[model samples]
Target: MLDIAKTAQLTPDLLRSFLVAADTGSFTRTASLVHKTQAAVSMQMKKLEEDLQCLLFKRDGRGVSLTAEGEILYRYSAKILELHDEALTAVSGPKLHGKVRLGAPDDYAMKHLPGILREFSVNHPQVQVDVFCDDTPNLSKMLDNGQLDLVIATDNVKTKFSAPLELTWILPERMDPSGLKELPLALFHPVCCYRENGLKALEKASRKYRIAYGSPSLAGLLAAVQGGLAIAVVTKDTTAKGCRHALPSDGLPPIKSVYIDLRFKPRNRSEVVSVLGGFIAKGLGIVI
Candidate 1:
């Protein structure tokens, strides 16, 4: 047990290190996140473990995992850090100022990002926000070209570092199925993951299909869908209010889960970007 006196002395910095370690499961990655050497992160954990009077990590040559006690600490650490950040923002005033270029897909920008950006703006009123909408591959290219500061990229299942969302097929609610011989598609360009998966599923099912509509803009896809143009595959979040989806019995194949990667140069020195990243992770209920 971590003694009450020792627990009271735990610093936000130490807890942050532990969190980075737990999220990434790598001391090197955690070190990069905290702007310290791998050795410094290790030292902080060692000091933290001593204070807690328990083994928090299962150390091996490869990496670390939370012990039973560490898992408990990790949960409490998240809440503590969240509250601490909120308090700090309240006390520090709206001092952070700068423009941040944030990129995401049209669907996410519409369905999810508004709340995230809105909350961030309420807390940091001095910062300016610039939003860019595009698919993941193009967004990745833009990020690589230094055209964007940060991006929420919908990566394929092969993406290494993040948890993926499950994909599904979407269509108008109560769409009639018995009359159709050929499936129609209203989707993004060939570079889009949902488009590719949706097409492949139809092909594997031996169903005939035609592209009724194609657009780079997600709004176009949704509009075409609303007008009874065609069916499309998208994340559950992106599905419209009156739309329904294809189930396994409908003959659509299962889509591979997609990872949403937060793209940025870790070494970049910008407090606003760092702060925005924290807000994004917190908003999405995911640790980056």
Candidate 2:
């Protein structure tokens, strides 16, 4: 039998490495992230498995995936690290302090910013983050003009980090497309990709459409959709209660997937901005 107390002692170092490996699904990437060699990382994981007396990872063609035991460990590891960081911060004081200007589309802000900003505020209460919500083009302009430190953009060409977003057509649940003479659109500004893609798709399909409502705010668009005023384009993960997804069979043409991209101002690449950018990337599951 194994010595329970001795074998079960999990050091923060091992747990941190394990978390990084699990999150990234590659020892090579994890090594780069944690500043260790690939061989050292492999040895650490082997030791971790030996200590735990269970298989934590399974090899695949691409990289590695967590076994059931590893999944459990991953969950626990995140909480463990969170608590560890909280304890250290409580004692050592907030190490990072400065202001960061962040910009994102209103929809992205509604979907992703809350949890990320909440955790960031907890960790660096001294850091003041001024957030601006705008369309991707405007945000890009702001970043290039040195008016913003970091920006999250949708369907952007240039990116420091990025994640895929599946596009979809959203409309009132009970509204029938065939009954209407022309499809009405609720969209953002003319420069927005969602509006552009949606319009291009409609035109290619030879479908008649009119801009029924226009709004920069996600809420306004959703309200227009829910109120049955117009159909709107949104990401698949949008969960407006009264809205149903429109299919290609419903005479709506398909919109190609786009990326949620992170961008940084070259001149404003301060430590605080970097920290915030890293936090946003981690939150969005994008590796920097």
Candidate 3:
């Protein structure tokens, strides 16, 4: 016989955590994405499995993987969560009126957010969104100062990183990384994650480097790289039209990709923030 009582107790929060863990394939990452502790995530998974009466995950040193039952749950959780979110948004009314302050890098603001925001606006025409486009560091500072409600920024901290975008080296397809006296780099402010990581890696490798082009605008960085002015460090998710693979065949030391993260400030006490967070996760199908 089925334990209908146990099954009935499954909550949306647990389902959301499970979804995040499934998407990231790591409990630690799942916690970061859901704003929970690692222990809390583990306990939630344990409780969820107990309720369903099945082992849902397999854990090893590499990370966690789903059991066959887990695969089934993952599929259903996505659909169930989507429906749940839809119900909430529906009840909340399409004429949801509120102002949402959002910040993101120029590249993402240009390429990625438009479709998501357009869809959001279509659903909630009364909601107003003011977006700021700038480098991650500056945007992060604004978020900290409570001038922004939500921010998507490049993150160097592995623990706090959550965004799915891959940060990589974007250089001219024709340029070579070898035999240069000082590696020329087109980058954002030194406070930026990509610039910081790239420089640290190069210095640790004892390679000479120079900032060949510096700009706060992604357009400037793309222009410099496309014109063959210099090699730039940028997110691969925002891969410009004229660029080659990162450090292709140059035998340079491997550079790690910086994590892009969505962060909410403590002062952002708005129900719309929660609603939009759900929208970004469900509507855009991002783990966030």
Candidate with top TM-score is 2
Which pairs clash in the backbone of model 2?
Answer: none
Q: Assess candidate 2 and give its lDDT.
A: 0.82
Return the lDDT, model 2, position 34. 61
Locate the minimum summed-lDDT window of 10 residues in model 1: 155-164
Model 2: per-residue Cα lDDT over 201-225, one tens digit each: 8889888999989998889999999
- Stretches of candidate 3 off by over 4 Å are 1-93, 159-161, 282-288
**Whole-model lDDT per candidate:** 0.75, 0.82, 0.74
lDDT ranking, high to low: 2, 1, 3
> Which lDDT tens digits does candidate 3 get at residues 1-288?
986574656577888788767766677656545667889999999988877788999975536889999999899887887777678677777756799999888876765565467456646767888999987778878988888998876676643426444667777768787877788889888777777878888889898988888998788988999898798776654454457757556745566776666778656758887677666554323474
TM-score of each: 0.64, 0.67, 0.62
The alpha-carbon deviation from the true structure for residue 248 of candidate 3, after best TM-score superposition, in angstroms, is 4.2
Give one digit per residue, the lDDT tens place, for model 1 in 1-288.
535674645688788788878866678656645567889999899988877788999975446889999999999998997787778777887788998998888876765565467558657978998999988888888988888888877766544335567778777766654357887888888988777777777788777889999998777887877777688877754545456677655665677666676778776638999888777766544566
For model 1, what is the C-alpha lDDT against the true structure? 0.75
